[model samples]
Target chain A: MASFIDFRNPPGSDRRADNAVRATAEPRWVRRTLIGIVLGFFALFLFLPLAVVFQGALAKGSGVLIQAFTDHDILHSVQMTLVVALIAVPANTAFGIAAAWAVTRYRFTGRALLMALIDLPLWVSPVIGGLIYVLLYGRRGYFGPWLSAHDIRIIFALPGMVMATTFVTFPFVARSLIPLMQAQGVEEEEAALTLGAGGFQILRRITLPKIRWGLFYGVILCNARAMGEFGAVSVVSAKISGKTNTMPLEIERLYNDYLFPQAFAVAAALALLALLTLVLKTLTEFENARQLEASRRVTLETTIEPPSAA
Target chain B: MAHKKHVLPGFGISLGWSVTWVSLLVILPLAALAGKTAAGGWHHFWETVTDPEVVATYRVSFGISLIAALINGIFGFLAAWIFVRYEFPGRRLLEAATDLPFALPTAVAGIALTALYSPNEWIGKWLEPHGIKVAFAPLGVLIAMIFIGFPFVVRAVQPVIADLSADVEEAAACLGASRWQTIRRVILPPLLPAILTGVIMSYGRAVGEYGSIVFISGNIPFQTEITPLMIVQKLEQYDYTGAAALGFTMLAASLVIVLIGNRLQAWGNRFRKHA
Candidate 1:
């Protein structure tokens, strides 16, 4: 990879002795200044706000924090968020797997278009994500008359919340899985078929195991966004206390009502969820790196030694 | 190529499921936005989108988003450089923390920022005497935009910088080229495309951002209000067509940015292959 940028040096050219000169290096002071600036930026923008959440949450006392948690409205919002995630995450996971399989396995027209469409939600504003649903399902919307005629409610209801969450999180699983599956390729599946394995057997025994870490990574990301989503869900939720509010909306409600401690307490809980997500993400990334390294070593060995020797 | 066959089973089922889900969940709703906008008639759509207050939001949203992306382009590039080229204490932890904005709930971030930057708060108290108001101001909107977009540039440029060889700079030095000259002529040329892609992506994310900006900006129309906020306000008023019109404009702008980013990325790949 580095060789491609080595315009003056041909491939495999020796230049190790020149490394002692440190010609390409910045001065010690320059390096320190650069690092200091970057660190300060992170401290100011990222770390400070994170610290403020916990500080504000505990400003009154731990007692108030506990009280806030036990509040019926806050508890209901937590339950509502859980219910939404329960409906959305699995739905997206299944869709992601199917989309990944379809995209990575087959050669077809519109493959690029399909992948782009899968990613469409990420680019669109969360507001637009909700607004589109409102256009289709609100009381005066496209299907509004039909839905009302049947006495069915979609907007400001559980189904609309789930849809908004699903829309925002739709791409995470498939996006993570596609690159991993494409890299692993069809050779393993072909070999399995040659051994008389059925489709489900191959999927369960081979494909699933191979992509398990990626799948977990994707699912974790999907779950984090599903639970934390604000804009899209807020648009459709109507913010009716105990009925439509999720955790983020609940925080907004508390903050707007001048319940600062309670708002931050709720936010701190969500912050903890975000922290847990980061930890799980880092673990999966570590596992992914190890898996890739092990596979690369296996490939190196197989290429070096004849297959018949095995 | 079109006739290529796959040995894998369930292709049809998988494709069918994916197509059906994408259509129902993603495409159809987006189409509804378009259809609704069209049904309102072009003249009404134009009037809503071009209304003075709505135009003010476009200025605030696009202007601040551009500024935030530019800031990220500079600072994010530096951060990426340090992470890739240097080893330091807590570097790994800091790198992981960069993704906090992406993972943390935006509403949480919004309030957290408000808490920190409000006049009575830690950072804000210091600046308040200097007449710099952050919360409930355009600066607050800018900060929120910057926070959400911080990760894009760093993530984009890190791999490219890592892949860049130190030997090229060494060679430039061997030829008696100055450090700045080598950086300008050799280093930045290859990195330009990645930086552009990152900046554009950040800009796109910032433009559509709603959650974080709502609290910090105070949603004062024609002041700190963003376009997405305008859409939501329109929806709240039951002005469905107006909301749809704004939504359509935003979606079109994002799609164009994405297409351009893709083009730049492809061009970058081609340049690398030739090099």
Candidate 2:
């Protein structure tokens, strides 16, 4: 994620040198018009809706916002969302780390296939994510009869929500780490191993430290999506008021019931969560850029010798 | 590569864990959907997915997604180019804002969009006198798709734009090429692939989008309903086979799109290398 839209100029590319080539640049009016159009698009589509979330939330005043939060059902929904995130994030993080290691650190057959499979969830719709679970656990599902006989509930329960959330967020950590790890190469881990460090030691001291920023970026993204997941969870949650509804589901319920202020207020809270995710994501990206620069400098200093003047 | 020995000790363990985890969480559930759909005979599956109402959703979903993706392709290119080439006040802020759609929950986006365009809200009120309806209409569905699919193109093309050195344009200019000529002959050639990939990606996402569209579109059957909503509606009616059939159809469509996307990306890389 951080690797995709790196805003900085790439190393060895000097913008100052490029700026000297003014003859190739667009005219003042052309450049200004493009910028204006882009900014206008952003203002109308992106910023306006975001502003409306808060404005609608505060339409009746902060007191209404506070009262909305204090509602019993809303509070329960918040707790349900947190609980789901707590379970899903760690589970997916562990899986992501393992998957990234296997895919990046070793040569293997079907490696490309494995990567595509890991990325499968991203291509699948979130609603399908939940629907699959229901097909496997609902009353008429494959194991539904046996599970019912044993008195175990999966769908319309916490476990179902967690599975749906986990499925949707499955790719974030591994996808983030894969490119970074591939770029870093396996030589460092090999070197650590040759020095008599054990497997865990090498991973703990070298690979983990090397990929921490990417890891954090992945976890942040996964956590945000997990907490805010709606479509998949909604499919399985059955929208039981105080029992199964997550924050996003609760917002939908309130909005559908014409409780506009409450719906917007709940949305405002999630919006804050989204804002926090952006801040953390930006910070991780900055750290990742710094790390890349440092590594590039190290490789340049050590690996490349300056040519002697002929 | 296969002959080389791995220095890592836990390759087997890591690979095993990865396969097991993915199998349990993703593959097994998907197989269940497949098995359920397969259990229903070909006739049943065909009838479920090809029902008139379901077919209308496909039209709405695919039609609107294509339009939205086309719109994003143009604006997303401009945004990516502006981010890479120009620096202005609030530029960084806007760059961050571009990602808000990705981070913000689709449900929140859905409601916020609904509020903003509900005929009495700020933006909606202005358009109301013109008799232009957005909310509860197919146009509203288009808006939701556009909002959710906006970032794909920008993110896809930004790096490609940055990687394109200004030296190429400078050389073209030195050869007496006009600005438009240089852009058409040199710039747009390589970007065509990236832009296509981006558009296809956005289209894929928009086709499967559920949360954002459900609110704004009001889920009116045969009018503004989407495919995913149809699947949910089937599930609610205890039409498990029907839901599975729709899901299977979408899954197959998305798979085909993914394959196409991969081919385009590879072709794009090859073009860039040779150029």
Candidate 3:
């Protein structure tokens, strides 16, 4: 408790003493009003709508909610969403780590361009992301005739859905990993190499452990997006009830059918998933902060020691 | 020269895989879209893009996006200020809540917002008596834009606020500057760049937003209709050329915004260094 207070209000410092005074200096009514305004803004804009989703879902009954989930078509949509996410997340994880490794571990030409290319998906509209697949593989598209000649389906099918999800989520894991790995530098891996470790051995024993938290966070984000993706997946999906519709698409379909309870119930399920992602996100943020502090300390010590030795 | 080589092995393999994967997934698809547009000839593309309905979408999308981003800029900054400055109950929860929009599916956000703002719904029921229509109106589109774009501003500004030392503020206070003057002359100058970047990014995102706005906007042509929705409508109608043209236009606009934002951010960094 003493150490904790010291951390918050460090001793023997003018700045800390100033902060201690400022913390309580704000007028009480002013603080209360500000808090009320912020709370009201969040409550109306965010919390109320989230509450409405649950309230609407359960307005009918628990039995109807169960039926909604078990319906043949909705079940298929849920499964399809799972399958796409399952495929996309792991693939992007590999791509992310590889990209992070390349860019951070080596000095290469076009590295900046590669970084910008990874961020391209962020700029492109999700609808355009889906449309790109259609332009490539739709019946009227460039590869359409060739694909049809071979009796292979791409667009408006499962493969196309997977492709679009991958495109939209391409940057997530890579974006997360790049900063972490770049901060770690290549010194540790070089040390392991000098110790006669093989490449796979070095990666497993040295690199992977260092990046595990970042990798985990990336997968969490990538999976959330893969499961939640609507626009790109919708464009590529044929929207056939049991065949191609993902969870988000099915929610729209059910709502359009005026099946309000069922629609919100499924949305409630996704809301739970979003909540889960939030929990994982907050935990990873804590871990990442700790890791950053540790790494910064190590870098500081190394820099100082090297200078003194020289 | 020899020391310039990477210490680790398999640089070639990793780089090869990353470039190949990105090319096949991201670069190729975008190229395909652009290629298809080019193959259709410039006249047809121009005609599709400049169609009056398409032009109306341009106006509605960019106009609402700009207005919504501006609102978010102010409110998001205020919210960030509350988070940074105050030690209140539920502060952590509210901070996490700010990320709700980002974590929630856009589709889910759309329907939920619609449900709340529909004429007979909770808030909407109260507003309807006063002659305000939120759901299925242009107002609803603006709301969705604000919902999705709020996080960009908060996340962008929070770090800068946190990095700012309180000692500086105290120094200004000791120098006999009034609170308002200190905020204007000492505080706002450094924060202006971050706020601008946040607003620009939020605008870019709002302009491209589709899934959330789709359920709320009522999809009315010449009113709530947005460019992305129109592109989807064209796709549904099997007008791939029209869809491509619309998508291309949005993509080009977003790219220009991002490029300009990057330049501005670099300039901001330089300004900070000089300051």
The lDDT leader among the candidates is 1
Which is the winner by TM-score between candidate 1 and candidate 3? Answer: 1
By summed lDDT, the worst window of 10 consecutive residues in model 2 chain B runs over: B1-10
Clashing pairs in 1: none
Off-target runs (Cα >4 Å) in candidate 2 are: A1-22, A304-310
Model 3 per-residue lDDT tens digits across residues B160-205: 7766656566677677776667678887788888888888888988
- Clashes per candidate, residues 3 or more apart or on different chains: 0, 0, 0
For model 3 the local lDDT of residue B62 reads 93
Give the per-residue lDDT digits (tens) of candidate 3, residues A1-310: 0111221223334666645444323434555787788898899888987998899899998999989988999999999999999999999999998899999988777999999999988877899989999988988888989999999999999999999999999899999999999888888899899999988888889999998999999999899889999989989889988888999999999999999998998899898899899889989999998998898898889878763644
Interface RMSD of 2: 3.9
TM-score of chain A of each: 0.92, 0.90, 0.89
lDDT per residue for candidate 1 within A26-97, as digits (tens), equals 544667899999999999999999999999999998999889988999999999999999999999999999
Q: State fnat for each of the candidate structures.
A: 0.78, 0.69, 0.59
Candidate order by TM-score, decreasing, is 1, 2, 3
DockQ of 2: 0.60
TM-score, predicted candidate 2 vs. hidden true structure: 0.95
